[model samples]
Target chain A: MENTTKDYSHIKGWGIDADPKNDPTYPMKRRTNEEHLGYSWERPTLQPQTVEILHSNERPNVTAVFGTSTPPSGLSGMIRRLAFKKTENDYGHWLPLILADRINVVEGIIEDLRSGHVPNIFAEKGYKAEWKYNRGGLLRKAAVAAILSYGVVAYFRAKKKRKHNY
Target chain B: MLAMNYRGPLRVRASQKPMPKIEHPQDAIVRVTRSCICGSDLHLYNGSVPDTRVGMTFGHEFTGIVEEVGSEVTKIKVGDHVLVPFNIACGQCAFCKQELYGNCHESNPQATAVGGIFGYSHTAGGYNGGQAEYARVPYANVGPTIIPEGMDPDDAVLLTDVVPTGYQAAEMGGIQKGDTVVVFGAGPVGIMAAKCSWLFGAGRVIIIDQVDYRLEFARNYAQCEAYNFNEIGDPVLFLKKETDWMGADVCIDAVGAEAAGNAMQTITGRKLLLQAGSATAVHWAINSVKKGGIISIVGVYGPTDNLIPIGNVLNKGLTIRANQASVKRLLPRLIEHVQNGVLNPKGLITHRIPLEEVSDAYRIFSEKLDNCIKPILISPSAGL
Candidate 1:
């Protein structure tokens, strides 16, 4: 998943169609100023997140991430534009802020995803029926069955030889 | 009016800014006492939904004290305790009277389409959210419920969502008295649905989840039995046998997206539609409910055209009601249940953290760390 993140980061704005004319920035097709403002409202990834600092009296303290990825600080938003998206936004580039603020949030959210449809522990429904006998019991039973088979084979061989001789 | 600026996941910080005043006379200013993080809020976290800005407050499930009222406002007064259900429906609108604000006919703008709740997706309606210290509630007289005094916020918190949502879940399933109900997933909605089923007087409530912790938690509130989805081969057959081969009378899919657990995805690798996750709770609803029973699907669906078995839906006589929950309708009674000691809803809270630790809380909840079922975002007032 971390590797995928790196790959996705590389493939950020360019994705499949990277055109230079639309985005003179070379890596991505930069939108004009009017296009930037126009697209900002409709584009969900650009939506604002509200983080609440709980005061003394409020009963509910829910921090709503309206419609965006992890809420980066003003600085990381800068890095996202300059280093990745290459748009000179209002935010200023600060790598420390990016590392401290955004990366951890990204990693944590990815960790929360369920491995399967269900939680672990009861995963092996098939293995539940496998506990008929322990290893020791199975070995002992096998030994007894083998001895009985060998004795029956010896008896048959001797009886056949005796009948032929007679 | 207030404006919003999107930043990133778990990173929404309100701006030191304000917007123009409302032009309408019906609008009221609400000093928000408490706004909460919603499961829907996490949609933004996972990049499923996107927003335009960071300055905008995104919370809708809140308990607020009314600060200012418009001249037209009469049903509510200043200094009143209120809970905002996650929508902005004008009571006079045709859809509001019909209780279908998801498609309201009046006061909704942009091609006469419904905007959204306080802080939600664009399809619902785009308005200023209430996750801040204050919010200007439009059409204030309609959905805001005055929370009675002496009610604990912890108990009342679900009033905005889970309590009524639970009822909605069972009600969506058309749960009749003495009916056997099978709820898939035991999150807040699932647990609350089970409790509501018991309240509505279902014969049995089988809360299904693979989490031992959530299942254990359900034992306290739910009157019905519990089934771990991982323990059974075919959930359909298993639920049927539990119903004496008749299937559950009502199947409520409360595991909105993360259905059953992570196990279903492991076996099917994101394609096993039934156990895929709560994302397809509707599918499970159709599959788990009896042929002639009801399916109350509370789990939200993503953009995916499920090839719904029309033949099966017709053949089974299944009744389905799925969409945004109207929790405001049931808050008064839910508050009574909470206050009267009949509903000890606080037991489901698995973690309590200072709201500053929201990013951490999101990690714990998402990762299922410590089997965290329901974590309450405790502010200073709650004394976490």
Candidate 2:
């Protein structure tokens, strides 16, 4: 118990002896949800910086990192190039194009039915029908279309092999 | 900056402090022009109020000049002289929207207990008070009202807490015209309660206290009959006899937990810390009021329960009204009273000391030294 008569004149300002950290019962139970009290200390930046990622028209060399030497002839070479392209465009470029093609196919079917022209199932109307891919760099668009076409071919091939096994 | 630091019970000293900065978007850093020692502050000073952390600045009644405003604060601007209500309320809360500013939900997430009060303790939201060079006032737009033109800072300071509390005490009584009112505790609030009772058309008003000088001061200042409970044997019986055995129409408890009438109350409530500060005044108010009369309580007690005479209250069919003074709700009408000279809120200020001598101010006020009725702290640079 400190004496009440002690002169504190030497102390310059108030709160010199205030040690909130040391107080036994201190740091009183603050309200758990006081943050919602409309009072905030969050200082938002006045000007938020916007970063734009520019995808250059220059397509990345699809096989540069894996070695530029082409495999000798036929199926092996084709498989190498396909694998390289898959790795290079794996930044989700192919998925969107495949989904778009499926959606376009559905839309085209719907339009045929609406126009009362969907009569043939195995003619040029079905085989010659092409997916309308949206414009991009012509080479990149072609690559995206080829990726989807390959997926379809591979899927049919797998179905044929499964039928043979059965 | 110098501010009042609460060390322990009866232990406070002015010490060096840092200037408060804006901590929230709605906060305002107010350079204190005036602050006051309130009767309720005594609860914190004496360690009667639980969770009163050591080293906290202890002053709830204050008036100041805004030095800075947060980005979101628009109602008041830097350089505006403002009287900050003791209750810190966010104007948008459901309770605040309903004019119950003291029960503002958003301001103190501890709304289950009480709302944010400046400089009381952690239980009241841990907001540092204005017993310093500057204080950080949260929700500045809602809680602080600019002191009106030509109003004395003294009067403005009282309105921050004392005047509004006293006015609310009387308002809660539901005083009727030509009705007798008895106010317990001749402290500043009681005196103000006695005075404000007349405004509510109370035909007769009386104040009771154990202190002789306070009783005299209450009579002189409030213009009401004042009696020392020690001098008058059995305060309830005395009131009954004075009111023709019908009891007073309204009774108010202005003395909260630190009341000094009964031995058991003082022992259990004050000494043992078992109950909320002494319920002596509450008991007296309950017993002395007429059957079915309203008992207004502005006095503060702990969040914990007190051993009040609830059976007596129930049998008497008393309508007890108690709350932290909704200062904002009553401010507009109170300002009118101040403007018309119907209330002199500053008349209760009996001592004015510089902020640096706040410890001495606390001692004098706490010890009842030199007939101190109310002590106002003048900022060293306030030039008051």
Candidate 3:
């Protein structure tokens, strides 16, 4: 949580629901004691963890059943570990984790290249469908990419010419 | 059996797969009849949700005919046309006893929050979805309800998720008579939320989205005010201005993780993978609602945290309620609503494609092509 000293007392009806009775769902929402009437059948046996499972820092244990097909690895795994260190509320926890996923995609492409396999970037990104179905948006994206590429090339060429003049 | 196979992000194909079998004594095998691709399924398809493994079939909202039932399953029998609620709840759980099936502790016990959701992802529970010709429905007695006699199969399929989820979104708002309600996202759920708000006596309902076609569709279907947020400068300011600066009494975030309209949110959350999808809709909801107003969230977000305005929520004394819709809880009333012509669940469908053309269905829906509002898949053996 970000620290803040700002007072919110000026806000109208601030803390109006601070009183338990003032709770909007007061009468309608109540704890039922029926929770004790738990599972009738024997609980299913816990699926054995055959791969690395990432869990929240708040949880003391991993879920009984988790997908093991995509275990975290590479740079993304390290960042995911860092993310899990902080509670789910913090930006520090999420941002680095997201950056890791993007990096992991690059890592996947590089691995594909290393294995002498050419990845179909277009089909993989679903751009073929975009061209067919969402032609306008696809063309707009293509135009932006072209303009950006041209600008980068022009900037580098001009820089080289300036160096020769110097 | 042919099933929609998840081949990572932005990829799904109809492929051959072994027919699903009952894994537990309480389980039943359902040969799906009507299946719909949900907005949340797009999150998994776009790779926004984590642990969506390759080869996983991804359909959660489905109505099917029971093929076989396990020994322990007594309430449901073979050949019964059943509408399976996406939540896989064990009827014996305390939450289920309280009618809070979506939060059943016995289901998806690994997660601290929501219960097991069909086809959501591994994070949801590694259960396969109904997008295939057949599905394994666990805890059969608890979640699968028989399709009411004479109910349209299209309506039955949607009752599995969309209608219930949309109705729950409005129900959570606690909309008093004549409360001004603002709904974010003009997707199928958002449109349904906007329409359902009227049932709670909302005087004015306005829906916001970036897509023009969706806004147009919402205007007609929901019979509510609609606007493109991209055209209207700051959504918070615009909503506040429209609501006489008092802000709407209730605001709903129907657009969850994949919300658009904010550059920072998109780059950090969607592109860079900083936050869990974009919190743009959530941010707008918090800022635009009246102080002490209720904000209902039905939008799907990653299990992980996203950047949200907690301070505003505290200072404004806002009430926030969110969860996966407990479909079983809402189904009875929603079915009545459908029967009475109060809600046209099937009217939302704009495209009907065969299960074999699922990849094209995904592309058409994902890209918002042909003005697609909702798409349903028909099994090759649907009538059979």
* Collision count for each candidate, in order: 63, 8, 1
In DockQ, how does model 3 score against the reference complex?
A: 0.18
lDDT of 3 at B58: 88
- TM-score comparison, 1 vs 3, better candidate: 3
The digit string of per-residue lDDT tens for model 2 on A1-166 reads 1313456777787556665455321111212333344433332212111211111122221100010011112332232223223322242322322233233334434644797765243221111112212223435757999999999999999999999999
Best by lDDT: 3
* Chain A TM-score values, per prediction: 0.21, 0.23, 0.66
- How large is the interface RMSD of each prediction? 17.3, 35.7, 4.4
- Put down candidate 1 lDDT per residue, B221-284, tens digits, no spaces: 6755777777886677788777788888888877664443444443332334222123445565
What is the lDDT, from 0 to 100, of the residue B125 in candidate 2? 58
lDDT of 3 by residue, A22-77 (tens): 44532223345454443343444344566676676555655334433245677777
lDDT of 2 by residue, B73-148 (tens): 8899989999999988776644565567787554442223567788886556556788888888888878899999
Better of 2 and 3 by lDDT: 3
Better of 1 and 2 by DockQ: 1
- Please give the lDDT score at residue A95 for candidate 1: 30
Model 3 over residues B1-384: C-alpha lDDT tens digits?
998877667767776778876556778889899999999998888888754555578888998999999878889999999999998887665666667778766556334466788887655666778988899888888899999999999989999989888988998999999999999999999999999999999999999998999999999999999999878899999999999999999999999988988889999888876667899999999999999999999999886768989999999999998878888878888889999999999989999999887877888888888899999999897883
